[model samples]
Target: MSYSWSTEEYSNHYSTDFDTIEECIKEAKDMGCKAGTTIWIGKVEEVDIRRVNLTSILEDLHNAVYDDVGEFAEDWYIEDIDSKEAYEKCENAINDLVVKYIEENGMKPTFAKVVDAELYVIK
Candidate 1:
């Protein structure tokens, strides 16, 4: 796998992919990255999209439902609803919401996971 390098002074900047860490280090020095500057080396890996966590969404929905219904009943509380059923019902809605949001506004900013990552200080 190709390797790339970045430093604290240029966190947003990465060197071109090289066959070796030794090449990355040489390029970092050539670019005048100072001694003691922290450097990171790694290969970029794609982020996997998976199911979204629904607990927080369920809790929020529960609180909202509780707030509206509790106004008319003294005994109403958040735990009156079954969480598993609630989660099951809202799963598609939440997923659809996320998909809609991504379609309208584009996917949220994501960073690649650096595999076989290493850190060093400029010498």
Candidate 2:
């Protein structure tokens, strides 16, 4: 059967004939669909999307890294630094870690931004 797909935002459209339903569905997803926009599909039976709680995962990772850094800072043998200096250093380290994660995952979360020497992405 033939299938057609289009997006409402950019009005991007595509149509093609496929031998199987799976093929048609795959092609529809591959076609450009603007983020956070609905896609109109012709003759689509069902759709399945894998979901993950990214915020929870990120929070856990951030906390773990922050705790590790804090512990390292507190150890006198690691560095002879006072509380204020250690706090500032840990903050910078956390920002760098978050920024690197964002880049590696190709995530464009709204909160992610760069200012001066620090890369901030929430927290």
Candidate 3:
């Protein structure tokens, strides 16, 4: 893995990669940054990318629909009580929905997966 550092004052520019965190910090101090100056250190690592399926996307939409409609029901009589089942029906029509979305938006839906990294601060 390679590591680099960036300071708040020069956030747009990141330092060149160093093999060790100690080398990164030494370079930062040599550059005249004071003791209290805030800096961010980042390390690059290889991550795996996986394809997401239509069923997973539809399930997320189903959960959102339930949160918006079912969760707020005030009484026995609620509006759009069948909204949750709409997702089940969507499994059959998902292809049509995707085609329509591509036709109207000129692009397919996209999703991203984020990986969290631990931050180490040097005083």
Candidate 4:
């Protein structure tokens, strides 16, 4: 097979216009496609646990970094995060956890942002 597919969605529960970090993660953790795992199972054949966590963290980072602290962000993780310090907080959180996953896995961080991006395609 030379092709595959996946789906991504904005965490609507937190995102009035865009998904907040907490909401993105919460939804991914609960996705039916996650195969009962509390996170998105990115690929069915070989699931990447790190990407799963990123799905959650990235949304939060986008919201906190963008400065749109809209109402309705009163979710579990969101509530814990003080909006004033969210930028550094979320950044550090993802970097500490998800980024480490990629590093340990030998997967370069930038690969996710670009198509056909992989440290090496294991055939």
Candidate 5:
């Protein structure tokens, strides 16, 4: 797939400081944000789903997604599925998990995409 912008929306559950290499690397394992890998189009994704605290909210969403990043590492590798399939699956999984988390916390997913994995601004 050409990564066409679909109807799939975003909701920033939370944000953390992954600006540094170490931070990015650590977050890649701890929170799933990568340092160089462009997951979306530019920089990491940012939505509008708010919580009591940014850091804590992100941690909560991280917890709700999987037991931990280790368990989901294989899924992130994308060796099992093709490139396009991987993106679609990632989108579906993220949307499903993120949407569920927001709804459960009594919030709506209505944020914007700040950046993709490559750290580019689509907006």
Candidate 6:
């Protein structure tokens, strides 16, 4: 596992293997990263495929499917069997797409993120 950081324009990018969150933060500060700069810490994935923004996909799904349901609405519950089924279907769809992508492009390391100084897995 590794960690990396990129600023708004991806300036002064820093990547290191097994760097603590404090260390990363210190580096970012030393490098003059702005206050709101996003410090992404994760492992490096080696893959032949182009990067796909899974976060965007998930966000789009949320806005389209889950955003409209109110708290007290009939569709608000996710623990229900129907909801669970739908969730599973969505999950399967994502898995299928990812698998197909990997099949076409070859395997690579999964995306990385930081979790309290620890490397977080994306897949």
For model 4, the run of ten residues with the poorest summed lDDT: 114-123
Q: What is the C-alpha lDDT of each candidate?
A: 0.71, 0.45, 0.59, 0.39, 0.43, 0.52
Deviation in angstroms for 27 in model 2? Answer: 33
Off by over 4 Å in 2: 1-82, 110-123
Indicate which candidate wins on TM-score: 1
lDDT by residue (9-51, candidate 6, tens digit) is 2333436544455666677677776666666654443433444
Could you estimate the TM-score for every candidate?
0.49, 0.24, 0.37, 0.23, 0.24, 0.29
* Cα lDDT for residue 88, candidate 3: 50
Q: What would the TM-score be for candidate 1 when compared with the true structure?
A: 0.49
State which candidate, 2 or 6, has the greater TM-score. Answer: 6
Q: Is candidate 2 or candidate 5 better by TM-score?
A: 2
Winning candidate number (lDDT):
1
Write the residue-wise lDDT of candidate 5 on 25-100 in tens digits.
4444454444444322223354554323333544556565656555774344323335666656665666677778
Cα lDDT, model 3, residue 17? 69
Q: Report clash pairs, candidate 1.
A: none
Off by over 4 Å in 5: 1-82, 109-123
Root mean square deviation (Cα) for candidate 5: 19.3
Range of the 10 consecutive residues with the lowest summed lDDT in candidate 3: 109-118
Reference-based TM-score, model 5: 0.24
Alpha carbon lDDT at 88, candidate 5: 62
Error of 4 at 96 (Å): 2.8
